[model samples]
Target: MTDTQAVQTPDNVAPVLVVDFGAQYAQLIARRVREARIYSEVIPHSATVDEIKAKNPAALILSGGPASVYAEDAPSIDPALMDLGVPVFGICYGYQCMAAALGGEVANTGGREFGRTPLRVTETDSVLLAGQPAEQPVWMSHNDAVQRAPEGFTVTASTEGAPVAAFENLERQMAGVQYHPEVIHTPHGQQVLTHFLYDIAGLEPTWTAANIAETLIDQVREQVGENGLAICGLSGGVDSAVAAALVQRAIGDRLTCVFVDHGLLRAGEREQVQNDFVAATGARLVTVDAAETFLTELKGVSDPETKRKIIGREFIRSFEGAVSEVLGDRAASGQKVDYLVQGTLYPDVVESGGGTGTANIKSHHNVGGLPEDLEFELVEPLRLLFKDEVRAVGRELGLPEEIVGRQPFPGPGLAIRIVGSVDAERLATLRKADLIAREELSSAGLDSTIWQCPVVLLADVRSVGVQGDGRTYGHPIVLRPVSSEDAMTADWTRVPYDVLEKISTRITNEVAEVNRVVLDVTSKPPGTIEWE
Candidate 1:
């Protein structure tokens, strides 16, 4: 295949097309599909029939939305998609749309199901509900329901709220559920979805991280050729570490990882990368201590975007310097470093408007804030993978658990964690508070449960509080602990009260800069995971 064609086609990658019907569960469905080791992508409902067919998806999934089918301008699917011969599965609002499109009766049922309901299975021989319990609890949220199945479809399941809760057209390989199988509240939800993906659609689960790593290594080898040199920006996070390791496996000693210490990282992050990563991957690493340079540039800057731009610029400069040093005599001998490896993930790409129908949330430093006239060709091996997938790949590459299990940290590091100016004293205070939060969370056995707890320093805001002896004015630290399937959306994690108390007491007593500790109970809708 030509380079352009090869870039378009991923070998052995089976993509499941998720048509978003404006539902919150759309991303959840995508994550569940990836958890099943099947690659999936989300497209807008506005996509044409030709656009849908262009993807050549192994299966199609219609996600639930909030729109009613009877309402004007409600999201609707093309009637011709049912005849495309691809196996299709619909959930919630998707189920209503498919039913109305395929000559089924759908109307406003007086009974509106909002929570868990008992499902009665009438057909065990159906492939969609095979090996599932006859009476199962399913999470539902809908006002209208399907009253009849489409022609050639067998009504296999029902609920009190709707008579035709689930249906299957075996011959055409079509299935749908009135409730979301992507939700965890439904106990057998994943099993039902897996049945549709594997048994009904006949798709193989071959999208493991190990397989992805192998393919990326080959691609990197092919792109770099025999004698080219590449440099990876190692940020001590899972993505960068895994990306650097994979590139090292591809080009051996030709890959030199440049780690720029920008004075905004958490405690001991640099040493972790220097000792653990180097020992694990055996890749040549160059550590540049440019903390003073970065802090000097960011002396009085308090705006998050401006800080990000300065950090990105300084990072590129540091990376260029490292490249020059690594290329010492080789550049004079006509050899050049032409590749810059990054660990940019799918969420980063999607959040940055790199995906179809996705909104631009914020600009990630590595992905969107880079210098336009940079010299190196970008090599992002994990660009299409998610955070959990990156962790799996890191483990598959035999990286230490410390590196593989490390939580996601921003490219701008602790500078963004502080809600105000970026400085040495503020950095130190926030770092101490953050370390205490990390320690207590880990001690309370909540490390893996909570994604990443960002102890934010509200340097611009201070409150009055009575300490042990007298009144004190100090910065308040905001503890943002979130739980998420992916970083795209998150819900606040309810940490135990005891654990919270300990974190609060320790931060106030140990680090004197802060007088109060507040928990951020906001979810991702109104508030992002990060404070700034």
Candidate 2:
């Protein structure tokens, strides 16, 4: 409940625990749960039975993984979990584990049903598959199959690879599916999850945007007290803008939104924040010109984490200094700014190792890169919400779509977009190339089709190219376009060939320092959306 990344909501927030089996999809499952207006968290499979029981969860979900249930080192669950009397739903690998744990027959099968598979419902009136198609397609990725149902459970669906594709026990309020119902590839993923939560788990949908905004405002009011002053780092991105708006709502006129222009932002971003944001939110604004300081601190730094850490430290320092700008004649009143508001999302928290068993993917400036001598207490209202959920809350607060629907941008800015050293020359070059790309994408009407497309400047790597009928060596622009429900998981977007060609052509023709443009087709698992 303090200034941490923990999920703090109203006292009525129902806690749903997701048992992660060491897969990236675990977080995706948690997001889906939140999409249904329910609160969920991912706990590692290594959690002890007592540790899980201590949470006194409203319900439990088991996530899918790559390992077989019978493998020697494969992760296993405590059999006692099934007897906890909570409605449990399992997917893919989780389904197999629960089957094996409950004395069901699991066979090696020597066959794998991956990607999309046809599922035949053997029981149309089944609890889990209720009202679902008799024969439909479901996403499957598993080597082992459940051959028999656990006692008191009815086998409802079957696939060519997994005969026991779906099963449920209405009396026990437990169910599972051999195929994954959490992925978008499954046509009825969300509907299936909704059925489980509303019918089987008997949970109420109380996590609406209105409820979320009201609860967060009340919590911020309690934390800041009567006379406390807060300063939010107002980056141009939607996350920071919404966070600033949310905090301003909690304590009107007392919250100062400080925007530090680090000079690494894309074109027109400064104007967007300086004019559009203030016109929309009407919050007290202070602009700090720290571009030279950021560029100097990052002059010889090429490591992504180092740049992020440096930026994070400088951001706090800037916020601390801006305290005086908003104080004015009240400086002698002795009221100090002690709170720093941020829009740290849930994906940032998981990617920064805030969640159990999640790898430290990268150091997000606000989450993992905060300096040891931080001066202000952190108040991250959107820290527990996903990207989509944050947008919904922004709309609920009556924020303009221009600020709320803006693409996701890193807190460290264009410094991270450049793959090499940080300097003015590289920053200017990347900014030009990035502008062209953004302009092209918008013109092609593909802005909403894919998520943010990062135009990276490979400062350290140059390629030979011919321009203006002469040979020249210049940097190559890497275009990374990905599609996703949330930033937690992403797949490379297959933009039309014409759009790609136009983007590449415009960048090469407009950017003088470079000659080539390249498209990155790697997805989230193997490569992150951002190059660094």
Candidate 3:
């Protein structure tokens, strides 16, 4: 059956299933699966064979984790799943799991391999290595190695340190690889993954943003049928904007977008949301000016989590008020709005323990902190997509580059950037400094080179400096420039001296209240992109 037919068959039918073993790259694996144009979902490794079988997956992928196969509490695969008829591919610790569960031995070799490694395919007849060269560079990160293959499995490839680097069981259509093919460190990772998905598993590479849009439109039509109006919350970010546009395409005039200007946004942000979004999608929009409400709630709050909670509570009230206004107008015409759409993405779901049922990290307002007693059914169109894929879909739906390619902005806005309490004066000072930094970065043609350059203001701290041959005390603003593949982990970008000089000069000269401009040289592990 075709992919669409497979999805339509039942909830049990997914083209691919990724078994997440608490790996940081588990989310990346899901992304790769969708890249292959086949629907995939993440389930915990603790899931039983019957549970996996109920999903009716065409193939199974085991994700790599930090744990060693020799650990006492290491994750294991179900023997029943191995006996199942579906094709299976194991990666890293997953390969060891397969070996240990199938009468093979895994031993810690006292030698750990990390990062990029080379593998040699001794046997080219194996289906997994059919089109690949005899020797290729692959990524490896493991402390244990499989000493032997299970009954019917044969070694297909090996590295200098690893003997069972690659193995296959053609009769069962099962394979395992010690290296990580999902990471970019491996040169031909995607190519290898595509080979298995298309050649070995026989999946079609028909997945594209256009196909996703079309399928979702049909599903939305069936779910809402006729005469059901949907309300969308537009954050002016790419996710929300794209979600709004897609829903508009699905139901046309029946969709209403609510844009909240929380007074906490950067310079020109509100106007961009008001003019650019409406011009691009032609959807009916209700712009709510809740700047006063946000500022009022954030009067004396300084703690980051406290500020987040207060702002979140106020936002919900403001949005509910907007929804009520829409309903009040619709009530005059005897129409009822039944859905509330959000721009939640796949990472949000995965981070919320869609796989392992772990506690979610409470960093954002939208993830799992929504009020449970709401009245409208949730509509998350972008829940199955990544950030880049969302951008692609936005382009396919004809959204403006300003709306589609805009960098990610936190919902808390400047409140989080200011280390202490927030007010009009502090926010204005930060905005001015931030604008200078952004202007200089764009002028240097480095906008796309960095993920985001957050200009932070130390509102409570002041530094001594000389201006016009006099001692002056003013707050210092910090420039945080980071480079990232996904927002999960990031590294500080080494900005050129010329670019830094230009930014520093502009911020110090134009912004009168600021005396100094400092650069943040910390990475994501020790410090997040934002100070708060």
Candidate 4:
């Protein structure tokens, strides 16, 4: 659920369009709609009427944004949206915009509602609030409130500060709520949204993982025909593994997976990909031991961006060599390779300037950091999916739990985990500390609670400590355990002190080079999950 909308439109399923108003709730709204078994898409608030009409949506949902309707640069809706003859639901900022666009009175109330507020249902017959509790708590975040309803709309619900908290126009098939219904903080929120989708818009629940998998497989086969050979880069993580598995299903033996060991991976990862993935899919696999090559190239490079670019460039070079070798044997038999497979997910696309109003944060090695003269066309099967959706597809394809449920690891691997220049010694030190943390967390059955614990090696920094009888200086390890729905935003996990003590003690005792361990208590805004 990155801000990215689905690029490939599902052919026959009815799509519900969720217009994003630069709100954080836009992705959450689309996800909620999907939870109801209905398909949804997100578009920017600046989308024109015709652009939205192009989606041929069954219903239109306006998402809440962090703008005031009366502000100079506030995002407003097109008046033509009201005449689209489709059911429309507006939340928060969308509500204010819709009200102002439909000739209703909206004023900037000095009393702004910031948190949970109670709503009193006045109209029981209203479609949005039908069969729900008369009094319910809803999440509210807005500065302006609707002062009066439009001519034909009825004010269905009210709060203490705002008389027009909710309103609906039955004849026009349009409604609005000043409070956010997409957040789980609002208890009957999903039900209200479901009512609008199924009961009002007449949309059916046809979006499923199984159907999506079949469709993607057909798409891949159509892209790479009967004779073309496709090669995938396996990183031993779920994203690439799942993408390769799907492509393998599409083209069978025509797909060759190339894995480059850059020496930045964690313990037991290489074996997992070489053994488990190959056995599960029964596809052709090629393993390249390029650890020394990567380390040599990254000898003095310390900047994160530079390291990522070098890794990406070297990866392409390594992959191209593998492809050429694989194709050389094929050329003797008159076959040519045409496609290079990548595991680029939707968030990678969005964060790299694909989404409507997003800025380029960092270059994902596989997507934005590829070299200019790449040889083959890309066959990215997981390009349009989120991580969870990719995992579901993995399960649907009968992949083992170890590969499917594996946590996300960066493409640059431990190179990004080390805050300084990477070397064999630093990698080994980080690996040992990382292994201890992972093993202890898993043993405590807290793996599910922590999204990912990036054990970072402060390779260039050293602190003084007393070992047996003398003073010793050693590097410190930073434990960054996070909890998140996606990698976009994350909060530090609150692991029990006993568990943390175990991880700290084990790493300090087992790994000689590591003396102290510190916890990263910062969230995503101030710091990323990975140090580098």
Evaluated at residue 398, the lDDT of candidate 4 is 93
Q: Which order, best to worst by TM-score?
A: 2, 4, 1, 3
User: How far does residue 500 in candidate 2 sit from its true spot (Å)?
Assistant: 3.4
- How many residue pairs clash (N, CA or C atoms closer than 3 angstroms) in each of the candidate models, in the order given? 0, 0, 2, 0
Model 1 vs truth, CA RMSD: 3.0
Q: Report the number of the highest-TM-score candidate.
A: 2
Off by over 4 Å in 4: 1-6, 523-527
**lDDT per residue (tens digit) for residues 1-532 in model 4:** 2333325556565678888888775767877887787777677777789977877888999999888888898788888988889889889888888888899998976868888999899998888889999999998887889999888999999988788999888677788898988876899888888877877677788777898789789889988998889889999888988999889889988888999998889998888789988888888789999999999999988988888889989998998888767775677887778898888886777556555465566777886678888888888887766677788889999998888877789899999989899999999999999999999999999877888889999998999987888788999999999997656567899999999999989998899998999999998756767786
In model 1, how large is the Cα lDDT of residue 503? 96
**Model 2 weakest lDDT span, ten residues long:** 1-10
Query: Tens digit of lDDT per residue, candidate 1, span 47-92?
Result: 7899778778899999999999989989899899988989999999
**Candidate 3 regions off by >4 Å?**
1-13, 131-133, 333-335, 352-359, 460-462, 489-491, 521-528
- Deviation from native of the Cα of residue 459 in model 2, angstroms: 0.8
TM-score of candidate 4 relative to the true fold? 0.92
Worst 10 residues of 1 by lDDT: 1-10
Clashing pairs in 1: none
Clashing pairs for model 2 are: none
TM-scores across all candidates?
A: 0.91, 0.95, 0.91, 0.92
Per-residue accuracy of model 2 over 1-532 as CA lDDT, tens digit each = 1122454434556578899998758988888888888988888898888978877788889999889888899999999998999889988888889989889988886778889999999986876777778989988888889999999899898988888888988788888988777888999888888888988999998888998899888888988988998899999899999898889999998898999998888999898889998999888789999999898899899999888999999998888888888787768988788899998988887888775577889989998889988888898888788888889999999998988888889888998899988999999999998998888889988888887888899999989999889999999899998897788778888988998898888888888998999889888887877877
lDDT of 1 at 203: 89
Better of 1 and 2 by TM-score: 2
Q: Which regions of candidate 2 deviate over 4 angstroms?
A: 1-10
